[model samples]
Target: MAWTEAKLIAEAILEGFERHFRLFRETTAGAQARFEQADWPAVQVAARERIDFYDTRVGETVALLRREFHLRDPSDTLWRRVKVEYMRLLPQINQPELAETFYNSVFCRLFDRHYYNNSYIFVWPLISTEHLEAEVPIFRPYYPARDGFARVIARILRDAGFERRFRDMRRDIRCLLLAIRSRFPANRAIQQNFQIAVLCAPFFRNKGAYIIGKAINGADQIPFVVPILNDPEQGLYVDTLLTGVEDISNVFSFSRAYFMVDTEAPAAVVDFLRPLMPRKGKAELYTAIGFQKFGKAEFYRDFIKHLRYSSDEFMIAPGIRGMVMCVFTLPSFPYVFKIIKDRFPPPKEMTREQVKEKYQLVKMHDRVGRMADSWEYSHVAFPLDRFSPALLELLDAECAGSLERVGDQLIIKHLYIERRLSPLNLYLHSADDDDIRHAIGEYGDAIKQLAAANIFPGDFLFKNFGVTRHGRVVFYDYDELCYLTECNFRDIPEAPYPEMELSEETWYTAGPNDVFPEEFATFLLTDPRIRKVFRARHRELLDPDWWRARQASIRAGHLEDVFPYPVERRFRKDREEFPRRYPHLADG
Candidate 1:
């Protein structure tokens, strides 16, 4: 009777996962229609909606278990049997790793935090994904030697199955051939095995569809991405050709929303994509393709492996301390853990619930290549011995409500994990003149991009942003963030007299949502050198009229195009074209 009950519980969880995956695939399959019709607003809505699918399904399954067994917390003996039965059901599952995460989620909600291990949960994957492959091949191969180079490129585009026709196939093909020729090695050692292999499906995001693949000779191969854009009036055209690792990595950046691509075996797709972007882990690749739950599972397994190999204490991240959160990072790890403080100091007026809502808003809205994505975790633990004395002290002082000490382990009830970056304020402090100019340019770009996406970072202080290894400025603080549409952009009121302008007291009334852009330089760009560079390049940012115009455009549903690559990388940008845009590419 006990074994039968355990099997019933395990089967119920697996059935719930199946329903989620089916709906997930159906929702993803709609991207093609959304792209073909040039419905960007629909695309954005779909992206946000898909993120909620997992939690809804989990809730339903948990409710079912409660009604059936009145099981608030089951005995350890019974739950262990459930885990064993769950493993038996995974061999034939298409996404075994994903199913394991679903099981863990259901189990964790009902069980205590102390049992969150291999005994009652999937601390490690039950199935081996290392050798997984699709029932149907994920990619199609084309032999350039047999079909000729130009024909093969044309064939690649046709095989992608785009509904829209190319505006100028001949010109675009020539541009792609030119770009590929520029990347080929100088030595004349052409191999007979030269071919191009591209994924059969298009990677759809926002207003563009990408063709992902690699070009190979015998010993050398380079990854490539061809971005296909619908010009509405001009039809479809290839915008640019991105070759090599750095270019591909930027297109699949952590800051961007996940791409919608159909794949039965996501593990195989990730495996095939590993060599192209070797720096990205399986966790990020899975997340990029829209399997966020499995990505979280993969991240935990990787973290466990990292903890065993490295010997580093958790330390407070170096920067100006945050007002509303306590953050720490392991010295050997690339990510940071952030917890909301039990109390906020003076001038910081918001509840902890409001801060969490801001974080969730960032998660659902399009990041627009400016905001960083964070993983929310609850009841996570670490060994007491791994913490530095100072970090432990800070946590004890600030995060008492969110933390607990169980035996030798410190468990955090709620926290967020994100990729660590050098704070922009600290980065500019020691940077040279040239670096400062570049960073200032990126800082302005980040603000403009986020504004276009309707996100307003309420606080514009330098400390609220960070600089990535790629030299891009990204906003990570979200406590005061709100939609741009919600803000009231207005100019400061004129003083009745000159003396009034110099008064320290308020000269005019201000609302909660009102923002005066003209006052930004006074507080943020205090350094003379930083002020000069910013004013020269981004003068429009300080104009109230300019902000009003952007708000109007967003309200009118004008979706701005935020390119992944630079203007110099584009095949055509008004009068400037590729090769001519770059100093090195001028002669080519």
Candidate 2:
């Protein structure tokens, strides 16, 4: 029988759905049997099997469509039909929770194609607390997915020509006076008009329902609500508008709940709520307020004394640039804080260009603040003023050579507060034989994930990476971070003569940014025992070919999965093998 293009697409989608249903049935049956026997480990193993099965099939389906139909866009009707077919199978699944997981995985894959390719927009709707409770029955909100959803909505609105309409209406001659008074109560009028325009727009209102349904059903997740305002009247007004939408009210009613802003701005409806946003320096604000309002006077006095006079107050480690940012642990605080000064105290003999480079390196830390957070990197940074008088005094004294005294607030370069982990480096100088083996294995895995993320720790010093509380190695130093793709990975050229090989300097001229991955092991693994272990386990990292291949895959847009949790939390096929292999670290 001859098939039209649309008919062929429909048949393909149905075929994919039938395959999904069969796999779902098989996996769930196995899982349910395990569940009945109270075998949680077996149940998890089954769940992983289901997920992997679905993942492989879905990938195959996508590839088949691409090859046969030349399908490229995720927003194509083919996905819509697939989603419809999947929904029909949802109620048929034996377990409701497992069905939800299957739906999330499929939807995530579909949405990710458009999202990563910059073809879709997601808008986040701010719901009232009451509506949030009603919409989200299960309370498992994934922040990253929710954020991505909002971004997609925002993109949709901009693409649908709603942005121009909203802008024109806001700037209309009729609303000119109100627009001028927008700084005051008249701001409410402008905001209301914009909301009304959005509600009346066929594209937005129609798409709004689909967006809300996807957020509600695709994952057991909900968008984070804006902070409730201090003023009761204003708060109630915003809350009403959020849930006032007849189409999206149900999804939100069941549940209770920067820098990239240029690329992913929120939809105009949500944009109106920007005035109520809290200041970005929330950590600093809360810390300052807590010390001022709740701190004891005597405790502050004693803390100040310790900061000024304690013999233990010394630089934790020497900085590469001679800039005075050092880690210090106080009895009052459980974590270690790195206090950086405003400027590097220039060396007396340093050239102007050298001083500029040092300053730029210091500024690079701030730039890295916006990069993706990984277990390998520091997560947060706050101002020095957030600390109490005692902490500030200690910081002032400890960072004396690096510190620049400013009027009440001492100007600092960048203050980084990080969790204090084990003092021993991955080199395992002080660790036992068993720990040395474990550290080497853990470090190898950690570096692979970091490289996959496109981050290269420019400096590979053992001191820069420390073993965490769980024996995982994490790179804390941000000063030498460079994109993995930015580096040129190549083998060292041969030395012309034996005398040249013995020279301290390189025979070939090297650019400032040029890095040879081949030299990493020699430069980092100085200890004989550590070198032996690393060579045995992670010899691939020392080869330029390996680095080049990984970089090429990344450049081709292949993203490897990197989980935040430990291996035990991961649903691996060989769940029983992990405990036996790393018995001491397996539990964590």
Candidate 3:
């Protein structure tokens, strides 16, 4: 057959698959009824047999395509056709009565979505290569063909309301992939956008169906975004438009300000500005209504109290240069910063917080756009207020590259700072839902965005970030943030990567046990909160056997902390007890 004729045949097969899937979806209700009445023994036998048949059929199809096209690379032109056919086979193979019962009872439901929504590009190797030739073997020793079937079955099970059934499936799947992924050379395929969508897909597919419904109805609009300039030399003015709120009154009660002291400014600049303090950011106009005062030294003392561990050295005078500080400590961290007001000698006793509370906090009624909930919800306040002239000068210098002021707001290009965080910082987890979602989303988007932008996060961890009031999560420490395409994403084993994944003697790529902290089990076991969140999100984190095995590894020295903090800073220091006091700095 000629190439054109072959191509025509492929297109016809692809269309057949698409039409078949559509019809299956349309008749799922009826098909489900017939499925339930099928004989149990016969169904199992048929499913097992079908698994073998499909493997042979699809695997052979993949092999033949490769040979016919003389394709040598991973993303050979031949893949486009192979993918279409494989996707077409999914509904037929997975929706069959026997397969449905087994498939819909697992956590691979997200994979089902991937198959349906056409994001199965990440797992294309499983369906495309017949030989499984790579750095890691694709087939399992104990269950060669069973591994692929299980993945398919798991996806079905996940779809059929059996997400909880495969709570530990992530670990197993990771192990299965580890046994296979590295068998090939460095992945010359596409960057993985797998997790980002998976993390948020469930919410959209199930509970948050409103967003989906609105989208389907063409009622939803594209999110509005304003570019945040990174250059301060542009101008000293920026007009940030705030929207996406029904009422701003609930949030505007707090003051806000951006302290822009020069890196070359006088050291006493902090003390000089101490008296004029609490100016609120325009974003927090509705919540501006707060006053407090503290001596510069006292402010640092109280700020230090919030450190869970002592080694967080960024806030210290050393890391903080020329007093251009952007401070917004969480409510749980304690109130240490003070605001001051302006006047002759700042009225002697006037503190920054007091001044901020007096004239900064503004009352507002409404807000409008895709404003992040956390951004609009947090009370905004800036710590120093006295030295407006010096502060303004510093702002001017930083903004020499790019700065602007629209109305009363100062818009300056602030540099994103990062740190080489201790690995211990990597293990700590937060219970905040918004934090979790944002972190996971960023991580997901990074694979694609970073690849395209030529940037990459050298170290990806849960604790490396915290949530802002507006629910935006930013990386504060830069130690591990680096250029994309700089790190290995393809050859690395998938998560839950283990050491001895396939068999005792069979070496593997990335497995669940690989690089996993042995103490992770103990940490989860000791902390009920960690257990709860892990169970709530990724249940595989809660398995005792897995934990025990990990613990054993820790004992055996198979696992060690990669980013350990300094020893002296490992333990919290004892603090002298003082009487429970409110904002005492307000008086004197």
> How many clashes show up per model?
0, 27, 100
Model with the higher lDDT, candidate 2 or 3: 2
RMSD per model, one decimal: 2.9, 25.9, 30.2
TM-score of candidate 2 relative to the true fold: 0.40
Task: Give per-residue CA lDDT, model 3, range 1-588, as digits (tens).
Answer: 344533643444343433433432333223222223322233223322322332233334444444555433323344344444434444433222212111211112212222321232322112222121232221111222333523642352243321123323433333223322333244534222211001111110000010000001123211111111111223111112111221121122121111111111111222221222223221122111110111211232333344433332222211222122222223333221211112214113434344233222111101111011121111112222222454456444433433445444433332211112211223235336554444444333322232222323333343434333433233332234343322322222343546555435434354422333232444433555544544455443323344344344434533121101122321112111111221231122
Name the lDDT value of residue 183 in candidate 3.
32
Question: Over the stretch 181-202, how does candidate 2's per-residue lDDT look in tens digits?
Answer: 2323522322211211121111
How close is every model to the real structure, measured as TM-score? 0.96, 0.40, 0.20
What is the C-alpha lDDT profile of model 1 across 1-588, one tens digit per residue? 878999998999999999999999999999988988899999999999999999999999998888887463555478889889999999887788899999999988777876787878889887887666546588999998898878898899899998878887866777777776666655767688888889888899888899999888887768999999898887888988998898898888888888999987788888878899998999999998898888887887899899899888999999999999999999898898999999999889999999999999998889888999888889888888999999999999999999889999888999999989999999999999999999999999999999999999999998999998788899999998999989999998888888988878868888899999998988988999899999998999999999999999998999999888886777775224544544453432
Candidate 2 scores a C-alpha RMSD against the true structure in Å of 25.9
By summed lDDT, the worst window of 10 consecutive residues in model 3 runs over 206-215
Q: Mark the 10 consecutive residues where model 1 has the least summed lDDT.
A: 574-583
Residue runs of model 3 more than 4 Å from their true location after superposition: 1-439, 446-451, 492-499, 502-588
Best-matching candidate per TM-score: 1
Of models 1 and 3, which has the larger lDDT?
Answer: 1
Task: Give the backbone clash total of model 1.
Answer: 0
Clashes of 2: 27
